[model samples]
Target: MSADKLYILDTNVLLHDPNCLYEFKEQDVAIPMTVLEELDSIKDRKQSVAQEARHVIRAIDNILSAATSPTQITKGVQILVPGTGDDSKLGKLSVFPDHELTSRQGFLPIEKNNDNRIINCALHLQSSDPHRDIILVTKDINMRLKAMGAGLQKVEDYRKDQLVSDVELLPSGHYHIEGNFWEKVSDVKSYQEGPNTYHKVSPDLLPEAYVNQYVFDDSNDFAARVESIDHEKTVLRDLGFGHLMQQSCWGISPINIYQAFAMQSVLDEDIDLCVLNGAAGSGKTLVALACALEMVIEEGRYNKIIVTRSTPPVAEDIGFLPGTEEEKMTPWLSSIHDNLEAMHENDDRPQSSVKYAIEKANIQFKSLNFIRGRSIQDAVVLIDEAQNLTPQQLKTILTRCGKGSKMICLGNLAQIDSNYLTPLTSGLTYIVERFKGFDGAANIHFEGIFRSRLAEYAEEHL
Candidate 1:
């Protein structure tokens, strides 16, 4: 609908995007007291959700603190977007207290149930403001169902940062030319430089080409990647991945074009940010690690490899585990160890070992909790399981990169573990869509499973 409707935001929405309040510009936002309690309970933790909880709480506090009087909150407090020119369209922020909402004619309360309390709060708002359109915004599927069942006319998931509606709609970073592509490119100027061939085509000819996007013409066995895009022309370079596919990195060679593209992205120093999306057995992490090792150990382009991942638990929170930070992160970083051991197999040196190579290459495992407020320079930073991170968390980690540093984000969107994230809203998808056209960024979607035949079968069937 329009931007004048009233929105009741669930806690999960705020955790998914702390800045969601501003997204519903000029729309009245009502925060349930139960949501505040939930945020307060989780704000002291080390997870990204806790950080988001704190940020949202502070933002709401700031908005309310600007109120002229305490009674203004009851009527409604104007939430201003400092630079926006429309004061007449400024949104209103209100709080719905648990005490103010009780078991009514059609609503029943479940004692000590936060979800039930939230739904009840929405029901109260819906009944009170029958003239104004009210909607409940949430990321939880069951919460939306319960809200719908509670007679709320409108309920939906937050979609502010979601560029694509589904994973199937995500950008493929490549386009296939079906016609006589060679004839289409006959008028284009071409030249060869070093290992790459360059072709300058009119921007109109390559409508779907973005910076660093691969383009293929299967009819003539021609493939080229977009090198640069400007208003006047688009320059494409022949991709070397076809030739490099057979070459071994550490001990692993790319089994498919997807893996080769992924390697090209991770090893290219010109590309500052690389996003890899693949399934469990697609060799996303393994290829990333192998490229990181090659860049750090053989090429000496970066000083070290810094790896990190979200530590989202499978079930309930088990509280804090006792150990040093590295020791505590070992459980979450088991995949890194497995990949490193595979890399060690190619080392023919008599004294070479996984421990020795890791030490020699200066590979460091970092916990995502302590990644903020520090600059990571001259390193190959690999963020694994990025699907579990919120877009806000991914932004924080990427901002930490300094000069001479490369950041590679690898994840399978379908395997996200975060309760607040979906395949379309995962941080990996965020990066892919956000940086799709940027010259310093590249994206690779792995389609092949290279681990083993059994692993491929399991990935496909199970």
Candidate 2:
């Protein structure tokens, strides 16, 4: 089909995904001059988004370099599909110089505010080009509302990285059968392999099953992990429900069945990545920390435990803090300490035991800023508050994992703090959906709140 629409991207969209320019298929894309200026101002900051801003600038430059003259550049430049020749069908990319326009004409005034100028640019394009559809794409909700209010033809949130329409549709990492799970299975070949039991059933038995996903029944009689699936059959590794509930790590046991699944994944050496999603007080941090300690301190499977998380104010406030990087991060990582304290509360000397565990595990608290270029190996990396991260930021961290390393990502989608991220676009959700089919990864969305009655009540009502 011929390209009939023009997409004007905002600054936040580029920062959210640097490679979004190529996702529009055959639609023409444009960047307002104000958006470029915003990216220029933010490219030098210490925040993770600054790196993405620089990438977007470089991508735009690479595409515009194909143009021979300034007129052709401002008008449009062909965006060829990567690895394709010049004859390949492609879309056009251009820079809209909204700063040169003097006519406001019923649009938002081009004041000192950059958002107003960008909205006015889209409004101008809508009126100037009556033949094509003009759409304003932004991650900012207020900016979209202003563009629509300014009489623009169309305004939409940047959804190129959004995999699901609603957060409710996300996989909970486990499927619960209404009654006895075995009763639903008609054709099944059960066998034993070494110490593990495996069941080969028809694909129609669990059509929605994915590798590494857990399945159980309400009767509490059966629990199994999907090991492999193909056109012929689906293989399941039977996990006795009672045994899973009885599993303990670092003197900590699962409080609920969902946590049992999470503990199993986190403690398993075969799984390289484990993603834990839940509400506040759902014991995500506690379970992850406990398993990390078990693997690092008691079992000696890993050399150390590395804990890190992204804070909203980390860009500006982290540099001003006193002492070392660990001390500065202690405030944001206080939740980790809280979990440690809770785990050692019953000990004879709680404070001393917590300090000893910290020292014994060789735990290091690092900032996400310094984790870009280092290769992490022989350690258990725990990333808390992963929902606040963008997909680009998460990719940077995930790629740093070297051989003999495991990553545990913990996040509460409802508590995302980034202004540029929603539940559908959060890095946690992206990884869960992207890695669901991978055999070496496991995802668990915890159930219930175990912190306290007051906390549980607040989580539901307040």
Candidate 3:
């Protein structure tokens, strides 16, 4: 095993992942005094960041109490997992006080700012231990740049929560086969149900397929759907959704196979969680909303539809917003109203029939602030703009689902508005990779733009 390395953690890294303390196996971690002060400033807020701050503080306190006395925290205290019995890799955690840095020679100016103090701490540690490797781990780009400018060689981002390094390499949940696809599958055990045919094949003999994933063969115009997979068998179902895709749902029809797969996922009762990722003008929102209404209003599947999003500002400040909760959220939810209005353009009732249906169907628009500590049941929960959510926030939202409920998360990973989040570590990509082969979960990536030719051209050209 390699020798343990010293890692100086930034405040943002801890807030990004509360369990980051134990993630560095067999390595020493140091927390700057300024970081604790920063945590104290925001730990009382009512958002996810505040919650994470509290979690980190609790973890640090527990570690200190379990180890040597509290007065010895500065000298260095060994941190061990409570019950893991793995002491060979147990690392030390310590807080570098301001006096330690200020007493050192050639130390940078310890300004009142937190970022500069943190950098100075790292610099002091590097100068003290010339034989050991000390790296500064942070999520802030500007902090990294400043550290590099201060002669720190080993600076990096916390990569524990990132699932995919490249967005293009993410799984598409669909595969295409050529040259006699049906003939290749005829030798497998097969049966037919009400509307779909089922086949069981071996995972080693065929391409990898997840439950509810789409498979198309353009050579013979054949498409298959994955039903289930187990150790002994891989169950496949025929694509019986072609005719259903042609049917109108709330005045919207499938424009492409991407939309068709999305519709099949949302309308299927067997799939409880559906995740959709795509760019603007790909009909992601419109398709999900259409199927949601059909299930809630027409088929009597779900009793209500609850809509919520990250509430990240697009081009305006949220501080100046005025009115009731619903009124403040109306602008953020304008796409929902616009899609509903377009669906009801040919209605014979008044122009406000969309509003009437929303009230009659028991659809409610909610803000993401209060999603915690509530159990949602018998409803279709829609989380739009999921790319702006952190992984911790996403976990809290998904845990709110109760019995007889479905959740649909839609987002464009390329348009993340969160300052501390990236495309690789956003909630949308995290859920997509985590739930790939899990039962009752399915994900689809839409690349087709059905809004208009100009929009499609812009998507491709601009």
Candidate 4:
């Protein structure tokens, strides 16, 4: 049997998603020896990426276990898809011994760099099999440019986990109407359910409506949340603009309607997951913290508040810091403290008020490295800087939420810090699009930056 295409895997791609092997349906995948060496070096590190490295190593071993000898491993091993019994749909996996490649006229010098070695392997495969399509798949942009510049035919980024093609096309969680919302509706049914008002209208009125998505009109008269949508009709729960603007939590009120939408979701007990996406200084962290404090301290709905975020790779080895876990995490979590201080800045004694609030709310700062295989119950989990996380990393943290818990993910897509992630591939964007239609999840994208005039100007011009 002849394969149409052959894809060479990169170390970063497997680290980005361990299960990416199954993403290619029928296309054969090859792993260079250099990639395995890179994973071996990273598997012993203390960072969260080390866990992913180990996972990829185990997955590759499991697939190649069926091979009998070194020759068979180099030739190809049939990959069996879990839960599928079809033999025709299997893709072959093989290991390319790139270290044994001799110095050739066209091959890049592989003295010490693993990237050059991987590129040379792809080039050798391309030359050996002229009929098959050879593609180099990686998450590194500079590597792609380098591979293409070194005379490789096709180089592509691994886009299997990218939900949207462009970040600008992501859902904003709210629909805006130019004129009056009621004027566009020809037929509608209005009623009162207990203290809440409901409106049932044609689904055509809001073509892109989703559950829990806010809707407003320019007339400043109508504001509602999409309660339900079906082929027959769409139901909306009327939320008055005046009432939304008047809502406050922990002595903090929203400065705009966008922020009010976010506060509404973070404060709602029915919403199990609330995702806030916006520019920096859009009050994502401040609003979530205020609502979390209100729930834990004022209402006593939750037992405590847990705050965590993915640290940059350079700062992942935080074990050397002196003090307890919370103390070690304080520098990384200073933004949380800043927001707490901002909330209490008006008090006679600001530092004392902040301390009292922290104790009263029972807030705990946690590290993402220690949040695995443990169930967190009766707490509010707030994940800040969510844009720096991959989808797999985000899933690990989200699954830690146990009984009687709510999770709030705050991210700014424009401020992603991960080398392997783009705005489209950030976990923040992934969850926003994936949870838009869920009944228990709400998403809000803040457009205004209320931190200061400098931040607002920097967001626009700089």
Candidate 5:
């Protein structure tokens, strides 16, 4: 398979998440001796990955030990590096605020600072394996730059977070129609022509998306509709929920998949920007993704699926974060992956080889701090962590959208992670308020949390 799939491990990759090695199940995996040395140095450090790496290394060693003298270990990713080949020997080096490499830094009292030695290890490997895909993988960007400058192929940090937006992991965007969709309810109760039906809307009917447009069609459907769009900002008209199969992230939870079908019924350009707001675990991401999958690979409403999140990091976070951006983003990006796994589990049908059965191009996991001034088009953009965004930030993200693109911002306004900010002042709130009158926008909120009884109770009561 010319997948060009030779991989090298970096120290920070293991530290970020120990299970990262599992993501490449059957691929040829490599770990520079420097990375191993780095891991050895940190094995006793009090961090989650350090603990995990100890176990991981033990497990891998066991596998290596079990391998027969005759049988080829034809499968599974292995952590390996060159030893007899490189002319270099491990050197001890110490790094301090004032430690400059130009000063002939040595691994003196310190055996080897985690960064430089592993880098030297990577460089040595590159020197030995010149062309057979010798790549340096590290979470440290500067280290990556150093490796590249040293003439080694340094790649971006590939966290098991699987941050890449694959065809299957992409998210969908939606629009809401709340403000004028039902404002002056007239007895004019015809799908077409007002007040001319003469049959009169029964007291039982309320406004809703009937035949793909909002009208006082009936009331029984609004709760489900509101509930569906509330979390996913999509309509559920197909599952016999009420309306037709309107699109966007309406409902895809175990309780709401029916609503998702209905929302798919209403999927159309008329309602482009869909809002799926929910308390954590309500399956907002799942449903948004379902709709996005539908439009992208199934219905062709989009060319690609782009999922972006803006953590906004609150001008003042509680304290300093350890490690780097990858470390910082792990906690937040997990929400997206959690939703994706749920979607994949729910999706039992056969899928395409390249694209996720219903989705494609999850795209890049962008930090809200970046993405400014970059224009996005021809895709369904999902802005997660929207609660952290201010009205201005939200506006900026939305303006980055180009022709034929739709965006959905999903966040818990009440969960407002940003400092000194409230639900009413969140960027999501601003977007809802600003786009209230736009026919292309839809604002929906999901109140029920589908994660766990304890979590829901905690969110509700304590």
Candidate 6:
């Protein structure tokens, strides 16, 4: 098929996402010979990567090997399908002075992936034919920036799936609720009408977050349902949770420290909402469920605990995903099961009783689409993988909170699944940004991955 765009594949781009080959579609794209060479080196390995590395190299090799002549071989920056080639000659690769491509960032002695050859190739291509556009496709943000800074045209994230920059994304949150005050709000006059919980603000933080749809009683400090101001009981720094308030199920689980504790929040009378945001394996969902179970079995706070993830397979992407939504979500939601297993492990209840609790625990594995019409009052709603929810979608889910209900949105911002900034503009930010001023409202940011040293290291380095 013929196409308009010209794409030059970088080594990292292919390795980062193996499907990189088809992403260019009908566009004129060519994997750099050097990139192919790089893939060859990884063909024989024990790791999972060896299979992919070998597959990509073998596929390309077959396509190139059968060509009868150079004229029929893959040429031009424009992509040719596996067996197709363009007769139009683009001439041998143009050569440019080495200085045109080198970066001072290179002089710093970083290892190979951040090397110079990739950058040089793009500069040479661009400088040689000013009219012929050469796009350097890479996953490295720094490399792209360095390429641009060096005067060559460059682009980061060549995953053809990327949406427009203006596309709505999940909004990253800000920590604005950093003060100490306690009080209650009575009339709640339109204050706590929804089943969703609302944050009651301390006298100190009056009228901070009433942007729109936010009901605020600015004149009063000691209202109902909101916390009552306390003067006698001090900060209680001795509780040992100095980095956060209240204990977390995973990180910095100090019962006392009240600095930057993170948890999902919902309604108090109906079902208390405690949100947890931590890196993968940080026990955010596990902890949220533990709390939910506590309320269901012990506190009698709510009828059931419902857990959901804001993700389902998109159409084109689901081809590789086996089975139905249940099967697909099974792998992704393994974390949910793992946590539930942990919750029920060693319990005295019978298998049926435990299964009943788990089933009756009111845990509903749901997609973001169904949350619109349901008024979830008197229920603990835990939304996992919330980063996948866009801002508008998240707003819709949050607004569906019914009377005496709690909703918890949890996700790691850095590990977003959606093509858009589904980690930022989503409802998580909507709630965090909208509810900081209320005294009854509390939030925490759990630091340090509790899974393992390697998991934490992976998050930091990779």
lDDT of each: 0.81, 0.91, 0.81, 0.91, 0.52, 0.51
lDDT of 3 at 304: 93
Who wins the TM-score comparison?
A: 4
Model 5 quality (TM-score) = 0.46
TM-score of 2: 0.97
lDDT of 6 by residue, 126-242 (tens): 666677667777766677787788677656565443333332332122222233223342322223333433443333343322211111122222111223334321111111122
Better of 3 and 4 by lDDT: 4
What's the CA error at residue 373 for candidate 5, in Å?
Answer: 1.5
Which regions in candidate 1 have their CA more than 4 angstroms from the true location? 1-4, 82-89, 104-106, 177-183, 192-196, 219-221, 230-232, 240-242, 314-319, 346-352
Across 279-333, the per-residue lDDT of candidate 3 in tens digits comes to: 8889888889988898889889999999988875522333357876666677898
In terms of TM-score, which candidate is stronger, 4 or 5? 4
Summing lDDT over every window of 10 consecutive residues in candidate 6, give the lowest-scoring window: 232-241
In candidate 3, where is summed lDDT lowest over 10 consecutive residues?
311-320
Consecutive 10-residue window with the lowest summed lDDT within model 1? 314-323
For all predicted structures, in order, the TM-scores are 0.92, 0.97, 0.92, 0.98, 0.46, 0.45
Please state the error at residue 65 of candidate 4 in Å.
0.7
Cα shift from native, residue 177, model 5 (Å) = 17
Better of 1 and 4 by lDDT: 4
Clashing pairs in 2: none
Q: On residues 206-293, what C-alpha lDDT tens digit does candidate 2 reach at each position?
A: 9999999999998776999999999999999999999999999989999999999999999888999999999999999999999999
| Every candidate's CA RMSD | 2.8, 1.6, 2.8, 1.3, 20.0, 13.7
Q: Per-residue lDDT for 121 in model 1?
A: 78
Residue pairs in collision within model 4? none
